[model samples]
Target: MHFNFPRTLGQEDAKKRLSAALASGRFPHALLVHGEPGLGQLALLLDLAQILSCEDTATKPCGTCFPCRAFDASALETLHHLIPIVKNDRNSGSDDDEEAGPESGQIDELNESISLWHRHPYGYHVSEKAMVRTSQARELLGRLRFAENEGRVRVVVLPWLESLNDNSATILLKTLEEPPANVYFLIASDHRSGLMQTLLSRCLHLGLSPLSASDFRVAAETLSQRAQKPFAARLLPFAEGSPGLYVELLENDGEELLEEALRFLSATSDWRVFADYAAETSPGAEGMERTTRLLLFLLRMVRAYQLLKATTPANAGTRIDTAEALEQAGWDDSLAAYLGAIDAVADLQAFAAFLESAHRAVREYSKPSIALVGLFLEYEGKANRSVPA
Candidate 1:
């Protein structure tokens, strides 16, 4: 199968710049590609990795080289797909979890990995890695321990950079600050808020916009011949520019409305609904996971809007009218509140970690519901908290 990097309409200009950089032989050692998911951000980076490592001297991954062949066979171990590293207790300083919930001592597991590529790639969900702990960061430093005699470039590709915790992120700071001879660091993350300012300054930043509604329509049609036009109309707006998200909605098995409602609440206060969703999600592991994801996406999108809009947040309503409702509901203060939402959403993983306690509470074996209610209250309170004095 052809590994197609489906370029969205507006992304061609960015591609042009990368092409120029390659042609001039001035490729930066590390590149930070920031964009919404579903824009083929990972695909572009993978293709770039091959192009960089490919023996063929072309602007693209010269369809002919050991690396290219390996890429085609999906056997290429060199292009390291680096995702957010979370800290897990099992990871007693091993580097395996770095790819999935990534941080430092995380080892990269090629087989049995939990991506959709194992079956229907489109259906893949990232396996949660434990939060990248300080030990994990040390594990990552271990990867660079050996020196390669060959000129092979092992590219580490992390899809979401914002997932790295403060301790884990510091490990990257050293490598990013210094230049390694052949190793390359290419990270693709949408959450700019979580990244360190000095980290942002260390690499070439490429901002990628999401796909247009029409573009997604064409993609959906191409993916499935029987796609309905009206479905695109409904889905495109919610994709929020990411074709992947649009695709996810179409495959949502009748929960599209719920997803949309969640998205709306995340973008705006919709205080009552969020409070209820949080309450509803608190009692069960599955419910909490789902609600937590909604909160995460909501925080991310709002943060994106916050950073991109040149004017006050009130003007950001031009994109999402719900933002205006939120502003009217008194959300027009510091970005700290928006950030709090991200932090709160991220804590759901902690809820997941304590699933046994939750299950006990759900079964009335323990007071899980009370604990959940407390968690939701904390989330709501944080959102309601204005910039502290």
Candidate 2:
């Protein structure tokens, strides 16, 4: 029986370590996989879950066994895959609505999400508004009440552990403290700090590093083939070391976001224009996600600008061609033009720092318009100071 792990880039060391542990029968009952998105943490957990439930011990998952087949079909009764979901108010009736569990529509959405995740674990995106509800946690506890099968292991796969609200986290903490025999919890989170310390203490933590350049290229190529699209080489620098992020940029109209970032930089000269842009771009919850993406793109651009400025003739005492720098960074013509426009007046480092802070603010659910307006105002002041009045 062969273990069927997802086709992901890099993290070979982590995988080997995990496989060894599983083989030695020393694997942790509760494992926490934490890393930046695109590092394939969820894929690792999914594979682990299958391995734990596999009826065949030699070579583990042995994808042919009934347990393995059931896992593949998402019909494994012992495998509980949990994800954050928005609660439906319409499903609420009694005061014990928390026990009512997910509505059929919600369940359908979850199943669909799981299906997509199985197909492309790295590229899958959950709704930003979705969160682990107290009711869902309660349902999980209820399911665990039944006696475990003598020889089979039950696996609870929870992704985005940081999305659990206080009540949900508290409810699950008990199970984590003393999980049923033969029950293992596999949890993944992009932001470990957002989780409770008590919860963190109960699990064996594994932190995945970013992919190397070569690994990222291979992963990108694989995903490109799967997506039936050419690799967007221009967006590679923006993705840093994350193929998941690369896939996201490829599918999420990333070029539009880049154009918007350029527009934002160009608008910084006029307060009214910048304010208008902010208001127009950030209207609501969806707008907040878009704004966050835009901010990340801008932050990357700022870093590029800093690099360019540091290597410029005036600073480095060497004539470094702007076009050469742009090409090396995989930056396009629009970005080149935007950087040139701000070259003299922008304090690249300070602006980059501000952008980073603004990004954190947006992620913490601050109003996007407010964060954008503040960012613009701050940049405007810096630009004004650099200009000759």
Candidate 3:
């Protein structure tokens, strides 16, 4: 059926490879697509699943077929989805019970989520706390036990498979090891390391890379037009070539986050100021989400500074001499100015590492105020040691 793929950039190679495999009748029954969270892995997985279940042999997804129409309307009987959901203890029914599916409210939420994702895959966001539970896995397994039409394909699309808990993963692994006839599993994961090795071995793996700058620009521009928002090129470097992330930044207060990141850097010049800023922006449990986004912006700046230092001629002597030089190197105006003012390349490198450590710490429930204070103290110590008496 006539379907519009998400306006994600790049992955042409991946599309070609998948199409070739399908054409040759060598497509893997369980295919695992892994990449960074915003690299469009889910979008690609959905496209592949739709193509696999298409009724048209000549054109594949000939747009007018029943399967194609069903898919478009999200009513395909053979197509299924397994998405992460908030764990509900009260709804924990026996695995053997056929009626122990998600509650009607959960089902409504799931359907709405899928609908929104279909409209704008890149812009969709799943709650970090949601995960695939054992009950959901058991329900899906129950559905698969029944026989299907001969020669008809049934596709199960699972996005964020990394969210599958240990018990749920074991349930899925059993099926992946010995899947039913004419069934395909299209799985996508943002964090491959979180997945079990046994599960990894059962699927044909495809890794996707971040989009190129040109492709990112095209995707960003398209999203901007559809969103009716002004395109902010300065946020491009922060996006690190992920259109999903780019869209996220655009929709969220990305510009403000960048500005706050710059302010944090400026505060580094004075211990008292830095400490005050740290205290003010300290992400107690409630602010952790915004703090994480701010940290990403800071990390992006640090990396950009590192790249600028690495690429400049040795004669430049680790100093970004002018805004013009940074601009020439493709930095936006604000970022160029910030990079131009920095001379401590070594300190920035160390700070980048610290930022990474802090990011992990915050995600692991460490106090963000302590992390922020630690950053200031560490940088101040480095600054003091580098200066002449």
Name the best candidate (by lDDT): 2
Report model 3's TM-score to 2 decimal places. Answer: 0.89
Ten contiguous residues minimizing lDDT sum, candidate 2: 311-320
lDDT score of residue 46 within candidate 2: 80
Candidate 3 has its poorest 10 consecutive residues by lDDT at 1-10
TM-score of 2: 0.83
lDDT per residue (tens digit) for residues 90-149 in model 1? 655664444543424444432333243323333334444534444445655556545444
Off by over 4 Å in 3: 1-8, 89-99, 311-317, 329-331, 341-346, 387-389
lDDT of each: 0.54, 0.76, 0.75
Relative to the true structure, candidate 1 reaches a TM of 0.59
Superposed model 1: Cα runs more than 4 Å off: 1-10, 83-111, 114-129, 132-145, 223-233, 254-282, 288-389
lDDT (10s digit) by residue, model 3, range 205-226 = 9998988777778877887887
lDDT of 2 by residue, 101-151 (tens): 777998998888888877788887766667888888888877876755464
State which candidate, 1 or 2, has the greater lDDT: 2
Q: After TM-score superposition, what is the CA distance of residue 10 in candidate 2 from its true location, in Å?
A: 1.8
